[model samples]
Target: MIAGVGLCAAAAAATPDSANAVVNIYRAELADGSVRFASQRLDPGYVLYLPGERVAATSDRTRAGTSAAQAVLEPDVLRLAHRHGVDSVLVLAVIEVESRFRAQALSPKGAFGPMQLMPDTARRYGIAERAGPVQNIDAGIRYLKDLLARHEGNEALALASYNAGSGAVLRHGQRIPPYRETLLYVAAVLARAQVIRNLGQP
Candidate 1:
């Protein structure tokens, strides 16, 4: 009985949001056959520590030459964004506005990860490990790419769908939903995306 109580206490202490918790940053062989990282801590896995990728800045230009993924992006995020055919700036923008780069962030609405993907969104992208930063970002980028295509390149509409759902956007005549949270989310992402682009300029 005492041992059982001790195990329960240890499990509670190891939850992701616990400050000072240690996490695995690289892949390692577990006791099982698969390679994995320690998921018990918030800061585990490949950290996307982008200081300048915040949602506060100015200026920008239209898409030209290669996409933003090919133009300027952080090494890891750039690779994932390119794989999904998404603009790097847009991905960073979404992360900034969603979870501010906090890998363990969880919304009250049950969205998880830096991209704040809901459970269904994660499942749709075959991402069972929503707590893993790389997997979460990859799935979110893929979903964002699809949203952009579905909305005919209307970034605002795409963002609205991300925040409020595709059905909500479609029901509103393919326009941004009237919800205050969705409206603010779209504007914030756009502003942050422009900032990311401007900072990359020479």
Candidate 2:
């Protein structure tokens, strides 16, 4: 049986809502056949076992503006990045450029949530609720991790792929795509990432 009682409690505490509030639950079957549960899918092994019955009402901070929303979501960003083996600063940068930390952000192209994930990308990662903060960041970070791996840790190429599609990267001789928007996007994310990293310094 899945020994998830403690894990479930931990998951609930990690969310923005009250500890008693309903939260999404995910299950992972370990190699030894044991099962684990978490509020967020920390890795590809975990799958959503139960969607939360009620979504948390938008917090006032989230509604105020980008900085406020970013402050509210930063913990999740850091946690998910650490769990998924991606740079937290890089994740923050992506979120800033994509949706400016707005949980319910919807792009003109139909990308949803803080990470601005396209529907196909969200579905590929088993994320049915793209507007949920934890779900969106989890899916986005995992996708970023895959892109980083595919590009051999070359963030530029990975970011370009994130913006223009991996096929575009491949078609362009595995270089950053030459599209103006993609070029600007890659530059902006990298610069923002550096800014975040520098902020931690003396």
Candidate 3:
């Protein structure tokens, strides 16, 4: 009976957002696979973070590239990302890192489209075979939701899962892998997202 009580206490301590000190208000996991107590928030409608690639700082130019991903689809992707609290800044950063806004970009690993989603993963998110910027982004967000759930709403663990695959994360049990490429990818996107958070877009 004593052992059961102690185990329950331990589980509660490992949950995300213990005291809500973190400003972001989103859940994240640590590198050791333990659930984080911090919270982060995602604001998808923040137009700056979702701005188009190559868009100028000026008002007129901003709208030039804005339509690249299709205005209609942009809102849906942003809405879903926000609803999932996945951080729109993170999404934009990933898009920049993965395809640089090139919807047709293809990687050797068979990742295709703007978000560079794998074929099997894309199918899971209902993404079509053809490359569509909005669809790709939407599917990427869906995949993120699944990863976040796997990590108990922990964003960092989910992110690592995205880069390394859920199987890898499962094998490690929420801990970040020692793989260099995956490490670099997560760090790069985080840094970029931080910049967006700080700068409020150009």
Top candidate by lDDT: 2
**Number of colliding residue pairs in model 1:** 0
lDDT of 2 by residue, 23-63 (tens): 45555666653345555677888786444543333423232
Candidate 1 residue lDDT tens string, 1-202:
0001111222222222331222222222324222222212223432322222333333453322234432333456678988878888778768765765667767656788778899989999998845587788888999999999997776777877888899998898877766645544555466556555655631
Ten contiguous residues with the weakest lDDT in model 3: 1-10
* Rank by TM-score (best first): 2, 1, 3
lDDT against true structure, model 2: 0.67
Scored by Cα lDDT, where does model 1 land? 0.58
Q: Which structure is stronger by TM-score: 1 or 3?
A: 1
After superposition, candidate 2 runs with Cα above 4 Å error: 1-66, 129-131
Best by TM-score: 2
Once model 2 is optimally superposed onto the true structure by TM-score, how far is the C-alpha of residue 144 displaced, in angstroms? 0.2
Comparison by lDDT, 1 against 2, better one: 2
